[model samples]
Target chain A: MSFTRPDGRGNEDKRPLHIIYERLDRVDGSARFGFGDTKALASVSGPIEVRLAAEQPSKATFDVTVRPLSSLPGTESKALATSLRGLLSPSLILSRNPRTLLQLVVQSLTPSPIESYPPSLAAACINASSLALLNAGSIPMTGVVCAAGVALFRSTTEEDIPALVLDPSESESREAVGCGCFAFLFRTEIAGSQPLPTNDTPGARLVWTNWHVKDGTSDDGELARAQALGLAGAETIWRAIKQSVPQMDNLPPPPLPSRSTAGELGIITQSDEVSDQDMNDAKIEI
Target chain B: MALQTQTGTSTDLNAQIFQRLHPRAYLERFIKEDIRPDGREATEWRDLSVHVGSISTANGSALVRLGDTTVICGVKAEIAEPDLERPKEGFLVPNIDLPALCGPRFKPGPPSEEAQVLSDRLASTITAAGVLPLSALCIHPERAVWVLYVDATCINYDGNVFDAALIAMVAALKNTTLPTATFNEETGRTMCSRKLRKPLPLECLPVSYTFGVFDGTTVLADPAAFEEPLLDTSISIVLDEGGALLSAGQLGIADKDTMSMCVSAAKERLETYGREIYAFLE
Candidate 1:
């Protein structure tokens, strides 16, 4: 190969990943993600009152802005936001809230040259933002998922065949003509409990937030590999979502009418069930 | 105590009630005694402690406390072309902010005038005084120089912001170590890291002391939060350990006589503050 990375791993393999949640307090949800050298912080706020006129009626809008701390827009931030918006919107039940707006703000603190599937750092950003949304008690979605992209390109010369790149670094992406990205939304479900009614479990529904790739070159065979990678990525992220929303395990029971009414009081008298005092005692002992 | 329906203090109200109800009077009394009802001096600064190397990841960092005023200062340096006008010198940019959460009066937004003026003043004074050796910053002369960003933040405020900020900034610069840069002929790029052993070329430590002159008479050093609103005049002095004044200027309203008196007082204040700075080294 004319260009080989210092590390022996093929261009398709990703760098190691580190994901963090609840990085900021003022925002509804926030996260900081690092993939090798690249670092990104993502925060989400509001299904609150719509401050913008364009976002109203029949849809919960997604507003995303990427800020690069050191330099102006690099190739990675814009591509990451566009792909993340597509992947994340599907996971949100935005159609239910006609006029509400959900805001996503991602800041790239440090730019790393690493490129591979899902752009691990960007994926971390989205994941963190989604968790922040959950923390804010926004209505939940059906499942949680994240996405990544891979590119495959061929050289004009026959001797040098097409190459499969997992995630192309900024330099490499510019050099190649062919590129492909996958926006995967993993289905999220509470691990220990059956699916509850939407009204009861507001934080349980799955909402996809992040997509990342570490490093790779794009070649003809990239799609098949990315799809395969997507499935595994979805499973891992599903596990993460379940871990993030642990409150689903002990949901409050639907509120029941008290015996303040005469008719209800009679029913309470007739029943031989344990008294409130007994329940309180049991709770204290436990 | 009689409950008054009116929103403000009634002149006839009892002294106890008047003291309790009048924020303005409470502030005035606090300034008069140079001592808070809680027994702290108006000019008497709060207990100041400095922690160096707080930001382990940063090139140089320090956390400073002046009474209740808490500030964090971090120094980050990057290599770039020197400004065309000042090719022989490195660049220093100071950013000071009163993040909205710090006080109710501050609105959430961009830098306020107060913050802008402080940062600009600090930057200009340090540069004009030749505190940091600008010549040392020149890597390729006209082609490249180092830009040092001094990010200073006020985490908390009780009063006397300038002194706290200056202390934090100086401690951060003192704690800072330079980065190593190597030119790679193959790539024609210079890789930079925090491995350099040499200290940044420094000329002298410029220490700042701030005093508030109230009613054109009381020159209070390190005015607390309550005094800031009551005071009529304020001044900050940046000086070296050698007792040579580098920068002396006043804010708000004060006559030349009062200003000069405050300046002399500030000279004494710097000696006291300088002792604290030296102690931190130990």
Candidate 2:
């Protein structure tokens, strides 16, 4: 039950995906992401002293969890957690903060036989974790953006697949067997570098691509199509992550400094509603 | 807020905070002038801007800004067994939270009374408005139902938090367009499909209007924190689109006459404020 494509995309192609980042004041760092059909929410806490016996010395410990959206964990989540641990642990710069723990919990939202797999969800989870770390004032990789899944769906009964499908729903995933995930990192970069100078470039174009399946079916046409869809997914995730990240940065300024009077913190009650003028007029000391 | 909690809930503490913050006299004057010092007529309201699909993670979400106030509302819906009592309906739970970081008064802990009160009010309003078509959420009546969690957060509190929160919440609900869920009669398993059905079953649009009473005589529409002082009482009116009132209440010291004044003030504001916001939403 495999779908074949000449160049993964035909005409009017799109990569379906959703990304969300919410602050969990309960945890040090947290974010939730849904790529194409796969969804995950990740929380990162600590840089504090490592607490577990399995903690690594001279470095920080990285913990990963993949909680599926629809069902309990199986082979998929474990594989995702293992793969994510490998990809993210090295990027943590753990030596900078030794004997600490960096926990990452990835909660996958979409669960089914056909939807985006855990691999792509893990990549997005890592990206979200990185962003959460940045929100927590922890500097990880240069920057982060979510990743999405792109699949080439062709009915087994027919030779020609439908138009290039972006992010397919669970039903779409079930119809197609050939699917993969793309990881995108969003960092604005100058067009030209010393080694890859942009002599042909006029203005700057911030490239947006991070990771994709390194090896698979070797058909040239199918490979091109998959790459193109991956690029499109990268662009889509970049736009969404870009929009969400700004709000995280635009936090309101800390509340006005307050002073305690009568050597005690005043108990505020319903009757304690103070006028704006009083908030300004009252003379108190912290 | 923490300060208030630290002090006992004795009438003295309540009186002190109320005296310092919400003075009855100030609100009375604003009501009397039929205008707020901020240059708004008694019926005028602050401008509003709403942006939807702002939060990527949530299934449906929106960010609404009214004057200096900002509220973020997100919807996360999940499938679960239906309640034994009401098997034919889905759930739409609305929760409002004000982070301590938003203001000095907000405390860090469980939701405050203000948050709980606002959530309950919004939840009831939404239910009455028929924002969620219960049948759409019903899966075989007593079998399964979709539980929607609507979380509204006040990131910034300028004034009239309730009005702003309501706007954001309804806007977010309006902005949300969900895909259809196909229930296979044979397998009995539900699958989400891209073929979107109709928008969430919405019956009517309801928004809340707040009136601040200062000086025991003045009726101030949408009072800011500064004018909150010298306020004698406050009123919040919930109305439908046809200029009909659904629910109205006063939140402080106000006589029956003052209450009538507050209602009239709220009605007038709804005529203008309602149209502008409703236009943005529709």
Candidate 3:
């Protein structure tokens, strides 16, 4: 007997995804991302003055604040914000603006049920923050980050394996035996050139993950398969994001660090010397 | 260069300067030697000690010390109305406090983000892992339920507070005993019998093991305060007595293989340290 999803979607199918850039005018970058009913609005303000205590000499301090709808920001929101900071930091090149602050605020547009696990809300927050960072254009980033939520549902038949569903709806999540949110970093440029279409590309680096099973042990291969499915879902979202933002292609490339400047800053090491030599060769060829 | 010139003569002074100025590089040098600055192996856990029923005022209390990190948890039971939707279920509210006395980094004020995050993680772990069944706390459906407020405070902060705070909370919960509560429907109140007490019906003892990834290669188990900030990626695994994975959380960038390695290591650690820490309760 085949396992059926509550919403009648295929096991691998995700809810409708929506991405809107520049949702707010005041912030440097802003975006609103939604997975069906679950939606999050993220705004980015960065390269701003750093608080005295949070200032880091070598890198920018990143701060994330998550506000839940119809309620004050609580421990749950703070936990989400902490995870968001860690998930989004890998794609951001914060070293470009040292001793400064980059702040990202995420507000949930829809209220999630109190008892349900919030994998969809988490995924939406991450995707919205990624898009907001891209829209800001101030913070240099190595790649675009995307996330997907996967839920494990028990099979109706006794002999069958649990069904893994992507982008689970609120009600679906409530019935899930286990769920996880996985975020991946997709590098847009390879050696200063845009790579081929990423649809067939493998190995998007895993940046963040949070998995929890309500009861009973999961099967050995269940988590690995869920992660793979999450990767596929995130890739689909990445493709959608790429298609929606034509201006992303026209954004100025990140500035290359010159050898002299790096040496003056006392950050250059033996490994950097090789890159410096390659830069000099390229300059001579030009 | 100026710092080196000032402390050139004394190697001790130079070492201190290196630790203060380039903490990450200093830690990397020690990590390359396959040893932490505190003389532990890459996967070595610090000394852990657990003591339960320490406080008499609270219904249940436990003190857990992992290395220099010390966390004390107290379980306070109170009578409250059950939510309308889940009339048969109780509430387990876990809050962690990192006061200014614990460390210099934490200030005395409202709950900081770190404290809130830890509290949230603990609450979710207890709920999702099914450590205790909420239905057991229901004295009368939709009328009154026993609410267990598991509050953990870090008296000394050395690092890996999540593990310490969780261990403390679980231990405290295990030591908790709720009074026999009876609802007086006429008075519309719940009365508790102080003499007759019953322990919480905990289904499983879910133990959590946290590992930090250094230089994206080496995994440090039970990272200390000094090591926590420098490491970017951390993986936490929660396992029950039967070695079943209850919950797992990872922050920052780490590959799947590393995560699996941490899980396997967590299982092995559960057999060794995890058992020893909870042995006192039995």
Question: Could you give me the TM-score of model 2 versus the true structure?
Answer: 0.44
For all predicted structures, in order, the TM-scores are: 0.45, 0.44, 0.88
**Candidate 1, residues A121-198: lDDT per residue as tens digits?**
455555555555555566557555543334444555656655556544444544544343333444435576776443
Q: What tens-digit string does per-residue lDDT give for candidate 1 at B103-170?
A: 76677788765676566556655654566777877666666677778899888877777777877777
Candidate 2: residue B96 Cα off by (Å): 0.5
User: Which of the two, 1 or 2, has more TM-score?
Assistant: 1
Taking the tens digit of each residue's C-alpha lDDT, what string does model 2 give over A1-286? 2433434533324333433345565777666555444555677777765677847777777777766766776444554565455445423566776677777777655554421253355445655665566666663554444444455554536765433455544445444444444443344344566543211212111111111221122233453455456556555455444444444543432232332321121211111224323333421210
Model 1's alpha-carbon lDDT is 0.57
Docking class of 2: incorrect
Q: lDDT of all predictions, in order shown?
A: 0.57, 0.57, 0.82
Evaluated with lDDT, which candidate comes out highest? Answer: 3
Angstrom error of the Cα, residue A2, model 1: value is: 73
DockQ of 3: 0.51
Better of 2 and 3 by TM-score: 3
Would you give me the overall lDDT of model 3? 0.82
